[model samples]
Target: MADLSINFAGIKAPNPFWLASAPPTDKAYNVIRAFEAGWGGVVWKTLGEDPAPVNVSSRYSAHYGKNREVMGFNNIELITDRSLEINLREITQVKKDWPDRAMIVSMMYPCEEESWAKVLPLVEATGADAIELNFGCPHGMPERGMGAAVGQVPEYVEMVTRWCKKYCSLPVIVKLTPNITDVRLPARAALNGGADAVSLINTINSITSLDLDNMVARPIVGGRSTHGGYCGSAVKPIALNMVAEIARDPATHGLPISGIGGISNWRDAAEFIALGSGSVQVCTAAMLHGFRIVEQMKDGLSRWMDEKGYASIEDFRGKAVANTTDWKYLDMNYQVIAQIDQDKCIQCGRCYIACEDTSHQSISQLIADNGARKYEVIKEECVGCNLCEITCPVEHCITMVPQASDKPYMNWTQDPRNPRAVAA
Candidate 1:
């Protein structure tokens, strides 16, 4: 079996799967349970000053699919409502008990250096492996000039990260907010401030749905609703892109990354690792399923790695970064056409309908002598957009076959059609 262990920015874990800081890792009971279920680490839910923050009633809402599956999760909740003293005490005890598992504490405080200065020592004394600066909470705490408010400003990100680095001996992981226009700015700021690693993407600012009858957004509170942090499988693409951006950017390249947002399975975790995440974090998946899901994640990842002849996580980590390039660098001469397999096709006209109605008219409908409807791709008109393949219900029914080409590889930067093409 391939080794799943990782030493992510000095915080070692038996496996790369760690529970993100959320409701699941809010307390010692939860952290202990998660460790028992095979999770390699836990970023204890964000802690703050002594009083803690008051959470609102009806803290959660969900965006569901047709089958009533949660596609996205929304929460208007604040940081840990429990007192800081209680939290620190619990963390100290938990870390003492679970010495092998990674014990990372997530914290958010006012932008002031004093606030961070005051809390860093207390948390450091808890024996936690590292401290994650939670600069990414999208809703409640941002109103108090913390969370996303601080994350949105690059200057604040650099300043606070510096404070943590200055005041604490533990590794500093800057948790970045997705609410910003450009995620790389904050990532670069974290690097500039001497952060050991960066974790992302934090929840996005979103209102999942509305209560139509009550005339408010959800999760409703006293018939009124407010925007909340949105996360889950729906945000995976956004998170992957942001991670890639940071990994590929010259300014932030090689900065350790703990990939977060919408990771549910081993494949998702593997994708993040391939894109340069040293470790991957989970939250919504555990909430939807349970801690035991980490078992499946570890098993699947290990089996796949073994099949691919990988001996360890580092062997494949960041393997995809080089291929993840700008659109301008993509090959213009390469082409593939969608091919429909008649044997695999369930005679579902979804591909034909999607292509003919919305996309290019690249598929033709045919009526055979037996009165059976058949759909075939129009080789001439197909742009190889894969719309037909995407809409097809059956897996492997439509495959894009690359055409053999003798032409030299050419990109937009070298194409004659581009006015700004580099001089030959």
Candidate 2:
């Protein structure tokens, strides 16, 4: 059997699946239940300085797809609302009971050495495996000069992380915010400050819906709403690209990454590992489905590892990172054309309509030998854009087929089309 165990930034766990710091890991009750459900670890919900902020009612909003599936979720909730003393006591007991599982405490404070220095010892007493600097909460906390307010500034990221490293003895994982234009800047800053690892992304700044009738946004409390952190399935692509960017960057290469955002299944976790995540974190999925989801995540990953002839998670981890590259590195000489399978076609006309009306119009309506109206790709006009394939109803009915290329290798950087190429 393939081993699911992982040693992420020196914190060992039975598996790489850890509950992200959210409602799911907000307290001892939730963390204990998650452990019973087979999760490898939990990052205890973010703890802040004493006098925790009050939360408002109607704190959540969601974006739904055509079938009413949750595309994205948004929330304006603050960090752990419980007292710091109570939270530390619970974390201490939980860590003592679950010795084998990784317990990481997520913390935030004002950007001052005195504030961070004071809290580190209290949390360190919990015997938790690590501490994650919570710099990515994008809602209420930012307004108070905490959370994303600290994260958006690279200098503050480095300065605060340095304070944590200075005062805290445990491994420090910097949780990054994705609202910035370039995620790598903060990632590199974390590494510069002696962080043991990094996790991304906290959440995107988003408004999930609008109540046009009331002239307000969603999650309207007393006829008012504010932009909250957006998460869930819709943010997966954005999260994946950011992870890859940090993993592949020359300055931050070899930094341990705890991948979060939109991971719901074994495949999702596997993709994160392949893209160089040392471990994976989950929140929105657990919120939607329940703690039992980890069982399937563990079992499915093990099954896949067995089929792939792998011995452990490390054997396949970071395997896909090599293939991700810049657009300029792509083969300019490569060519492909879309092909339509006649037998599998249901004549949905979706492909034809999509191509003709909005796309390149590379697909044409024609009469087949059997006198049936057929949609076929116009070979000469097809740009291999795959828009038709994306809009097609039948899976595998339309595929991009690679054409044989006799031309030599060429790239835009050095090609004649490049106006910025330097003289060699």
Tell me, by lDDT, which candidate is best: 1
Worst 10 residues of 1 by lDDT: 48-57
* Pairs clashing within candidate 1: none
User: lDDT tens digits, residues 1-424, model 2?
Assistant: 9999999999999999999999899999999999999999999999998898789988999999999888899988889999999999999999999999999999989998999889899999989999999999999898889899998899999999999999989999999999999999999999999999999989999999998988999898999999999999899999999999999999999999999989989999999999999999999999989999999999999999999998999998889999999998777888989999999998888988988998888999987899778899999999888998998888999999999989877777766778985442
User: Which digits, one per residue and each the tens of the lDDT, describe model 1 over residues 127-185?
Assistant: 99999999999898888899999999999999999999999999999999999889999
Candidate 1: segments with Cα more than 4 A from true spot: none
Q: lDDT per prediction?
A: 0.94, 0.93
Instruction: Judge candidate 2 against the unseen true structure and give its global Cα lDDT, from 0 to 1.
Output: 0.93
